[model samples]
Target: MWFSKFFILLSVWVMLSIEVESSTHWIVTESGLIQPRLNSPFDMERPYDLLAFLNQEKRWDAIFENYNDLMKHQKVIDALWFDVGEHTNSGTQILQDKDCEKAGNINAIDWHASILDDGSEKVPQEKYLFPSAYHGPSTDVPDCKRISSLTFSMFAFEHLESMMQRDNLSANPEYVLPELLTPIMTLDQFGHWVTGVLRENSSSWLHYHMASMFWRIRGNAPKALECSRRAVHYAPRAYKDIALGSLGVVLHRAGKSNDAIIVLSAAIDHDPTSFVNYFAIANAYSVIGEYNTSLKYYDDSLKLNPGMELLMRHKYGVMCQAKLSLRIKAIRETLNKLRDELNVYTQKQEAWTKLQTEFLKTIKNGEETIEKKAFERMSADNCA
Candidate 1:
């Protein structure tokens, strides 16, 4: 019983003896930009905390809150957030059936085949025309400066990029001008154009969904959440997953990982085939330290989008963290065993020391008795 108690105490002591190292996991460069660092080898797989980096910048809040401030600091914002030399239009294609209806008869067969490949509903061709204002400055002379549908779509995307500094542009081309006209428009003009488009297309869920992405990337969580909710309200039953996924991402960015997980789960239920939703949910789980669960979702996403290098990297990082955690656990157990052994050795040493002291005292008492007896014998002889 004593030995068991001693082992228990030794285990507790070993646990308490472990110390947590205090260290910073990021650094500020000469340009005043914060960058993440691997504080230890175990942290190599950790994800970059973008929200934390943005929070370190004093101007981010002001720029996100005020449109004028954001436009004034657009160059700085782009340098900080925008991908270098990457085209803004290279985003996920919106493959809704309604989008197929807009293409003319010449492209109808191709659109149908694409939709069919995705197992979505077949779309019927429909005639649609945009208001004259949506056209370029050459709207007055339509034949003189006629633009192809593809060029017009690219122009609208550029205008959206000018305002949002990201590719969160609405795929709908009914609310923007031609490429020839976008180059001459100022930042204020682009803002006004976006406002006008939103006002005119208040019922269009895709616009609100794109707007939510814009706000999300701009670090305006409240506005992003509001826009996401509006998008959910206006979105069709078939396309609700897009809005829900956006909401989940917004919540994750706002430091609400648990809430993000709940919303992302719902998004997955709505559209299980969307790899992006799975990836977002995986990230949410990762933030909350549910690495095993995160890995499962990451694998699910990889199955859907096999070519996603980014997802692969994230998964690899999480795996490394999981391995590190196991290693730490094994180390703690080893320390506990070593502590128990040391405690036993110390007790045996104390017992041996006590035995040696008792033996030495007995020898000293025997010597004292002999000396007393000798003195007594000498006294008797003197008396004779």
Candidate 2:
């Protein structure tokens, strides 16, 4: 009896220890951009990269079939980091999802969410979209420009990316344009923060530092160069970090690799770890073919949070031993191109069948949500 009692006490102690050891934390860059503070989720970070953060709970549920799998089995999972908002600090789209799945560490990051690989879903509906907005041009902008990037988690980011691309050409697009969406979440966060900083303090140095991010998001058309040049003159060491980093991104995007390096080096001197600073540095290095240095900074980034798969794929995606490419090789490939099957139902046939079934009771009772009843009736008759 005493042995069993002692064992019970020890088990309780161990459980407490596990919670204490793995408790989540919050992360805020120097600029005050907040994120969940999980350990290195990205395996590496590098230049000319992308980090796609999606809120796809359903696919995560499928990939991480058990709860333990969230923290322990990222090696088999890819796309959104499960502990992103739950245990770590960042949510919302961290970056675009292009080519993210092709990289190798998707499973690695997701699996590392837990030690035991408990891949079960205890949370509510996995496909629910988080209520949020994509960082837009400025706070002064109208709400429509502020993207409510609400997407069902049942569809992965990559799937959504494909949808966005396809729909962009459609007569009635269901979502925001990819061009606008990329900047706000991908690099727009930095630009918007800079604008806020400028409002708080109009130091010339700050303006100069913010120029590159402005141009990059704005697209590196020739007109953006003057904004960056003025930023250099207005540079104060305090604000130079922000200015140079932005300038570097703009220059790299404009295909001026050499200028990007010179500009970014000066910025890093002010302070590293500004919002996405190292990632931009890696981007500059990649443009100049300095993959090793890019890889070094990327490694530095991973030390802070290793699940930055977008950066990893971007910097090393072209390398012979790229993690993502290798993972693609290892996994069985499939055709992702979806078939759009449209079922046409005349009103007579549609209303006659579905309304008589799911909708009849729903309509009579008036208790069902309008959407629920409509979809049920529509589904029953294959009517829109």
Candidate 3:
């Protein structure tokens, strides 16, 4: 017990030591450049403690005050590690701006709220960087100056405009506008930390998935398809499969079923083991009225998981629905023949009732999918 307690204490101590020595970049030459000095006193998430400290009725006001405070101290701290510049940190700057613009409510990132961005960012013209202290070796990037900041908020706010493009939103009602985005701000480029974090974040693409889904729900398929396609291209391939599937669905809905097929096929190529890929492709094929192709995909789905009773049942459901109207007529005829042989009027009545009930049920449940498949079979049979 003593040993376990001691071990836990040791771990905590190690974490504190690491946090205290937060700066990752160091000047390197043939000789170890300069002896490192003070332990880092500037902890961003901890010192501000936005989640803990800022619990105001007006959340945006709290965020502005807290951020203003954090940046305010950067210029004076002697032991500070990084510097503030406009472009370098600009990637994260618009996060706040977007929230304020979207809600007209400023409290986007306070405590519980999450914010997102779409294509349109509250992009600042220049001088993008977050507040940080620096003396020497601060990199000057000219792109920062291209966009200008008005007041404390970055980006061109001359006209009242949305911070994010219309596409970047989630359709889920649980989400609010603030959950995904904010104003653009730049951070100081020091020891490569600022650029490293921002680049990895792909801040420009922030809230992209959320917004794309929103646009998709509104039948704005073109924008959804384009945004998700970009996300799939730039994001890690494993994480990008959903984007591909979503893009495929948007295409399918917009009457671009062939394009939908191509996109889903790419998903299959990406992960043959994924049942989601098979199902999505199967759905696309079903949409195109290629039942033979749909059947083939159902076969593929079964191969992936024969025990998936759900998929198997869905396949059976499709089969029943495919040649439906003819099957219904045939059932009626077969019932008549059985009743004629038996010459049992009462039995015939019951059989007829059962048949009609089943036919109605089939036509009722999955009526759309079944009807669509029936139309395909009807068209093909007519051509034959």
Candidate 4:
């Protein structure tokens, strides 16, 4: 009975081992490096330390603040595009449904909330509330930047606007003036604002910078490329490196490998120590089968930012392709060397065995000859 039970347990363990070995897929890390994931069905299910997530929230908050400041300055650049009216009491909803429950209060911010509340849950209850319904269009620019802040809060909602659009409560919210209650900010509103901002400030490379981001989020590659190019065109000589590098990346994404290489090369010339520019140049060269140049740039990038897994993966990929191109020659050279070594060893072994065998045979014959001569002498003595 004991033996049978042990066998069954061993069989189950073997089955589980096979299942684990087979259930893995490629996943990209937060740092944009590809890695193997074991049965990760959901984004939240991926392996991550809770402590790190908590620690990162502060950094995320700081980023949110910076985005808000940038938007404010952006509005200042094109104040005409924004509605300028009196301050009005706007009904704004900070949380809805499950988000409100997660915050412990239907209308207050809870710092220790376990639920993953996006920017909505963090909204100030005194300034905002869940609007009963979408308010009608308002030309009034009433007081309180909180409403405007909410529109920009979309940036803090999530890392990618795509993910926010999918998960947020406002899937299809109506647009109203900043003074009135807005359940959510639509991408259409975002695009319109960015377009107007760019149009109003033609010389402001900063507008181009923002337009590039908006276009990228919308998956409009051509518009993104144009915005990046305009950004580069209007950038000051001192800031050309960043704008040029951004343009190179956009070009590479748009499948203009040769153009990307040219732009990235210029960026490298402007800022040779920038590892990101070098890596981008390497990627562009790789697309055109310039493995040697790609490898060199990859190495240069690694020198500038050693121990980055993303750079290492890029370098490793190029190294593999370069090695594959020479695989036939390498294999042939190795086989030839091995064959020569084996042949020399075999010949030496055969010659030593043959010499040893001959020596043994000659010794046996000498012994037989001595025995015969002794036998004959003994016979003569007997006859005498």
lDDT at residue 223 of model 3 (Cα atoms): 52
- List the candidate 2 regions with Cα displacement exceeding 4 Å: 1-215, 315-384
Tens digits of per-residue lDDT, candidate 2, 156-261, equal 1122232223222112111223233223344445445445544544433434333333443344333234444445445555445654555455455555556556
- TM-score of each prediction: 0.42, 0.32, 0.32, 0.37
- Per-residue lDDT tens digits for candidate 3, residues 138-169, read 35321211111113222111111211232342
Model 3's alpha-carbon lDDT is 0.42
* Tens-digit lDDT track of model 1 for 1-384: 875555445434433443332123334469763333332211222223333322322222232234333333454434423332122222222122232223212221211000001112211112111133433332111110111111223212222222233224222111223232234443234334444556655665555565554444345655555566666666677777777787666666555667667777887888898888888888778777788998999899999989675676677666655554554555565555556655654565565455434323332243343245335534654687
Each prediction's whole-model lDDT (CA): 0.48, 0.39, 0.42, 0.48
lDDT of 1 at 157: 20
Q: Name every residue pair that clashes in candidate 4.
A: 85-141, 86-142, 86-143, 87-142, 87-143, 88-143, 92-129, 93-129, 93-130
For model 3, the run of ten residues with the poorest summed lDDT: 154-163
lDDT of 4 by residue, 70-125 (tens): 44445443442222111111112222223223323322321111111112232345
User: CA lDDT of 16 in candidate 3?
Assistant: 50
Off by over 4 Å in 3: 1-207, 302-313, 325-384
lDDT of 4 at 95: 25
Worst 10 residues of 1 by lDDT: 110-119
* After superposition, candidate 4 runs with Cα above 4 Å error: 1-192, 328-384
